[model samples]
Target: MNKVVLVTGANSGIGLALCERLLSDDAEGLQLCLACRNMQRAHAARSALLASHPSAQVALLQMDTSSISSVIAASQEVKLRYNRVDYLYLNAGIMPNPHFDMKAFFKGLFSSNIITMFATGEGILTQKDCLTHDGLQSVFATNLFGHFLLIRELEPVLCYAGRTSQLVWTSSSNAHRSAFNVEDIQHQRGTQPYSSSKYACDLLSLALNTHYNKQGLSSSVICPGFVMTSLTYSILPSFPAFLWTLLMPLFWLIRIFTNTFTLTPYNGTEALFWLFKQKPESLDPQAKYHSLTSGLGNNYTEPRKMDVDLATSEALYEKLLQLENDVRKKLKEKQKESQHVMHHGSFA
Candidate 1:
């Protein structure tokens, strides 16, 4: 039987590659759902995949992770379509209107390789959409809170299914512990909202593992090394990306010394694809997988320092439950208010 897989942001990048790779695997067939915000792009992606593997089962679902209504609607659609989801890949994210510092970029170029890629703020950028539909930062909403809610909504299917299910989150090496402040998960006080969002995802993944693994649901995180995806293209201007592309050979050499220098989407997604072959119990629930590249351009998978504190992870889980309840209560109150208005008009 085929496994039902739901991949968010499957229209492009690692999500698309993961869907293609899953379809190519011979162990089982896949009922792959590409949950994306853009229907046209999702259609094109679905068509392209079906062209190569005509027998591939593909479905498109419109979802904007920044909106609570969109998440709820998409989850309801999934519940109606599939009895169970064996795999859930939370891959949709945003770095809206990133401000890349060119001076920092050149300064890091002259520094040591590690500093150039990891420590320095050259490759780092700032996002603009700190406001979401839920009054949170758009980055945190799409990357963390929205997906958190999606998982909550789909828990019945993922956890109580006939078989075990896996939830893989596309985290980042740049997700430093300091980037996240428990007090302000929205990162309203900082310019590095993307990093903050990723950090929150790290904590959220840990929380999921701790809370739900015993219940037969497993959650893990992976850093899709620096992928040259459409996301990257959008963040950096064409000229910079082109320049970075030209330096691809140098990047491969750097990958030998620094694991975070993964320069391609395929290599960046290696860990994500590799995890698909494993049983949930065999994985390290507390660790985040790193998608690394070798010196010769070969892709490899490794484990990096996962900054997961159980206390913090648990705290976040409780916070999420409160947020979910609050959102539901607010929605119910609004609906009742609207109904009262309608009833008065009809009586009048």
Candidate 2:
């Protein structure tokens, strides 16, 4: 039997790199599905992957992780196309209007926390988040809730009696417990919605393991470290792309102190690809695997224990379920309104 793998946000960056790696690893018996919002980019990604591995099975599914309806429709499409999902990579995420604190970076450089700041990007970075059409925080919706809903929707294909399925999330080192609040799960009042959302991914993975492990489904989260993708380049938008190239030497210097600077998307996907080859049952649920690059440019995966507890994880799982129910109600109402508008418009 052929293994089926579906990856969200697989058009570019680490997601795309992971796809390439998967094909390179097993081009014969693997069916790859690239789930992306942009059909154009998805086509390009499929073409590029085929260019290298012409015999590889690569398909595309259109999905916008920020939209509830889009996720639902895409899930239906997925179930229609594939009976079983061997691997699901929840890699879609967004960090909007990022603001880098150069002053804090400099301060941390002089302080004893320089290594931590560089590794985690905790003290020197923030993002301005907005509300989605569903009235949820855009960062939270794109990064956490959307993926959670996708998992819930695909439970039938993911959970089987004898077959095991794996879920690998593209989490971040910036996922801090301090940024997350159990009361405001959406981070509506916080400036660090990106961090909060990633932290939520960590907790949700644990919850998923607890709930679905008995059903032959396993979930794990990974931090790609600080890869210089378009997402990272957006942080310093004013700086030209060439300027980032000029700073490569500095990044290498920092890599000596902090191995989190994986730099390229391929290197950043080390842990994701590593997880693909592992038995899900043997993986650690309480750990967040990290993709690390050394000063000499060697890449490896490291498992680090996350700062989460079972109580918090279970509480977050319940909160997400409640939010999912609320969103379903809202979507049903919107669909009915659309049908009603069409019914009245037909008479006109």
Candidate 3:
């Protein structure tokens, strides 16, 4: 039987690159589905993949991870379309209104923390986060909660008795424990929602492994390092695209100090693609795999122990479950209210 692989945010960047890589590797053995908010881009992605391998089984599912209703509806669509999910790549994420700290960046440049700053982007970056229609933090909703709901919704397909399903998240080296607060799991009060959400992904992966491993479902997270994709372009909206190309030499120089500058989507997807070929049962729950690029431009995947604790991860899992219940209840109430309005208006 052919393995079914579903990837969220597979329209562009590392997500799209991974799709291409997978098809190039096994167009016949793998069935690919692109779950994206923009069906237009999804179609383009499908066309691009088919341009290479016309026989490749590529499907598309419209999903908006930031919306609770959209995620649930998409998950239902997925369950109806596919019997089993072999690999689920949770690559949908957003980092909006990023403000680069030039002062801290220059200070770190002359200080001893330059390499650390470059690798993790800890002190130099922050993003303004908004709330979704569900009243959850947008970054948290798009990057973590939506994926959580999808996993829960697809538990049947994911936990098929004999076959193991792998969940690979596109996490980040920028995921900082300092940005995350247990009390504020949604990071509503934080300026670094992107970091907080990625950190949550790390914790959630471990927690998921604990709960789902016995049922043949495994979850892992990967840091794509610092890839210059459309998301990166959003960081410096003032900078022209050509200016980024002009800085390629400087980016290469930085790669000598830290291998985190994987640069391109293809290079950044090394860890994600590597995880696809691995047996999920063999993966370490406490580790976050990273995509690394050497000075000579060779790409490799490295597994690094994450700074997450089981106690915290489990606590987070519990909070997410509670939030899920609350959201579903509110949704049901809203649906009833809408139906009441429609029924009353019919008589009017």
Candidate 4:
């Protein structure tokens, strides 16, 4: 039987690149499923993959990771279509209303932390996050919570006796410890909701390994470094396409000292594709794999110890469970109410 690989946000960027690489590497041994919010984009992605490998198996799934209902529905569809998921790539993420602090960027350029700033995007970028229909922070909902819900729903297929399943998250170098608070996992009070949510992912991945490793489920997070995707381009919305092209030389120059500039989507997926060939048991529970590119433009993966600890991760996990319960209860009530209205009448 062929291994099943499901990737969320697979329509573009690193997700699409990973799909291409996987199909190219083993067109006969793998089944590729591309889950995206937009069916048009998903079809296009599937078409593109099929165009290259006409004999490969490629499926399309519609999933909006920001919505709880959508994630649940998608997971149910997944379980109905496949016996088990060998690899689940939680790559869907959003960074909305990004603001790049040029003052801070310029200041960091002269400071000793220049390389750190360029590598991590810390102290220089922030985002304005809003609420989802589920009443959760949008960034947190899209980046972490919805993926968590999907995992919960897919537990049956993911956790099986004498078998292993992998959960690979597209985390980021921007996931700093300072941005996360156990009391504010959603970061409703903070401007850097993207960072906070990503930090939550790092913490959550650790907690998942602790809980599910014995059940044959392994979770690992990876930082794509500073990939120049649409998400990164949003950080500098004022810069035109031509201006960004003009800055490529400067970016490549910066790559000499800090190898975090895996600027292309293919390079950004180095760690993800690497993980595809690795044994889940061999991966470290406390480490985050990073996609790095040298000045020579060679792509590689490196594992670095994350700052997350067990206690905080556990606390956040419990809170997330509570939130999930609350949301499901509310959704149930709404469904029942709608049924009642149809049984009777809207009014009189």
Candidate 5:
């Protein structure tokens, strides 16, 4: 009866690294549920992990954080498979339309690329997704709202384990001071929607902590300092990413000066991996954990100013409650009508 931990985006990047760290810990004996969008990648990741820790119990469920229906289905699967959920790492995120200013990039190079990227998550200038089926900006939906919906759907299982259960959100240091306009939460007016979405997650995570901690759900936010992941790889053309890989070692030198520069997925997940070893009450509700990589590739933690207004967070929580209720009601009505029609057809 090992504690169940569900990590979204567990197929690659920091999510995958964190999964390995958790399973390798002989003391915890965590039963990992790798919630990933691509089943093939999930299976491959599981196979790779199994080669090392044969005794590890890892399950895969297809979860696209961008889709509300997918989140619901994945949560239902989790409910069916597990009796209790001890940890929910909401790590699936997207940086859509990361247009980088080449002139600014070159100018900042002499100073600190780590600090420059920390303020603006431009990893070597890449194009972003322009379309999403949800009719909203893809980044906002996938990075923030989708994870929010998954947490809402899994509230039953998450809260079943009591007050100790944790919700760790993978927020970012690039969550800029002015990235999010509370009125335009979708960031339709902005180019840096990814930063805005991460900012929204910070706000939402704080909201969850303030309102739900008493209800047995504790929420925290962590940043995986710029990591070389598939997400980043997709941002740029093949040539530039390849070129950047050559200069990655130099980035580590810059990382020491600026604490938020983690180059690898393993280093990026330090904050998240450390949280698994901590008690909920021991964490600071307002402080966001920053994962850092030293010049020598050693991992370290730092605290960042999580610009969270509790009053606004509470309002967002109330709004989410109304939205959740509306969605549940519509779903229930459809289900009841379907059942009635089926019953009549069977008898007639």
Candidate 6:
């Protein structure tokens, strides 16, 4: 039997690299689904993957993880196409309008926290977030809630009695417990929405394990470390691509002290690809697996304990369920209003 794997944000960066790695690992008997927001990029990624492995089973699904309706529609399409989802990679995320704080970077450089700063990119990074059409924070919706909705919608296919399914989230080393608040799950008033959203993912993954483990479904999270993808390049938009090329030596030097500087997307996907080959039942729920690269460019996966507990994970899971209910109600009302408007317009 062929193993089916679905990856969100599958067009580029770590997600795309994972897809390529998965094909290279098992080119013959793998069904790969590339779920992306942009159809053009999705098609291009599919073409590129197919170019390398002509006989690979590759398909595409249009999904904007930030949008609730899109996720619902995409899940329905997925259910129609595949009977079971062996692996679901919740790799879709965004760190929008990132403002790099040079003062903090400089301060950390002079302080004893230099290693911490370089390893995590914590103090130097902040993102400007916006509200989505659903009246939720865009970063929270995209990174956390959208994937939650997708999983909930695909529960039937994910939970099976005879076999197991795995949910692998592309989280980050920057996911800090301090950034998340139980009351402000949407991070509407927070500047570090990206960090908060990822932390939420960490909590949610634990919650899913608690609830779904009995049904033969397991959830895990991985931090791809400091990868230089388009998302990272957007942080210092003023710095041209060639300048980044010049800074490669500096990045390599940092890698010597801080192994978190995986640098490339292919290297960053180490933990994600590692988890693909592991038994889900043996994984720890409280651990966030990290992709690390040594100075000599050796890549490996390590599991680090997260700053989360069962109480907090359960609380977040309940809060998310409540939010899902509210969003679904709003969607239903909007649909009814649209139908009512059409009904009245027919007489005119």
What is candidate 5's lDDT per residue for 242-329, written digit by digit as tens? 6776777666666677666787788888999888888998888888998977766688887776988887677766766665676567
Q: Write the per-residue lDDT of candidate 3 for residues 14-126, one digit (tens) a residue.
A: 99999999999999999999999999989999999999999999999999999999999999998999899999999999998899987997798789887778767788899
Each prediction's total of clashing residue pairs, residues at least 3 apart in sequence or on different chains, is 1, 0, 0, 0, 1, 0
TM-score of 1: 0.93
lDDT of 6 by residue, 298-329 (tens): 99999999999999999999999999999999
Name the lDDT of candidate 6.
0.93
The TM-score, computed over Cα atoms with residue i paired to residue i, of candidate 3 is 0.97
Q: What is the C-alpha lDDT of each candidate?
A: 0.83, 0.93, 0.93, 0.92, 0.80, 0.93
The Cα error of candidate 2 at residue 182, in Å, is 0.7
Rank the models by TM-score, top first: 6, 3, 4, 2, 1, 5
**TM accuracy, model 2:** 0.97
State model 1's lDDT.
0.83
Residue 159 displacement in candidate 6 (angstroms): 0.6
TM-score to true structure, per model: 0.93, 0.97, 0.97, 0.97, 0.88, 0.97
* Local error of candidate 4 at residue 323 (angstroms): 0.8
In candidate 6 the C-alpha lDDT for residue 51 amounts to 98
For model 3, what is the alpha-carbon lDDT of residue 89?
Answer: 98
Taking every candidate in turn, the Cα RMSD to the unseen true structure, in Å, is 2.2, 1.4, 1.3, 1.4, 3.2, 1.2
**248 in model 3: Cα distance from truth in Å?**
1.3
Candidate 1 Cα outliers beyond 4 Å, as residue runs:
113-123, 238-245, 341-348
Worst 10 residues of 1 by lDDT: 113-122
Evaluate residue 86 in candidate 1 and report its C-alpha lDDT on the 0 to 100 scale: 89
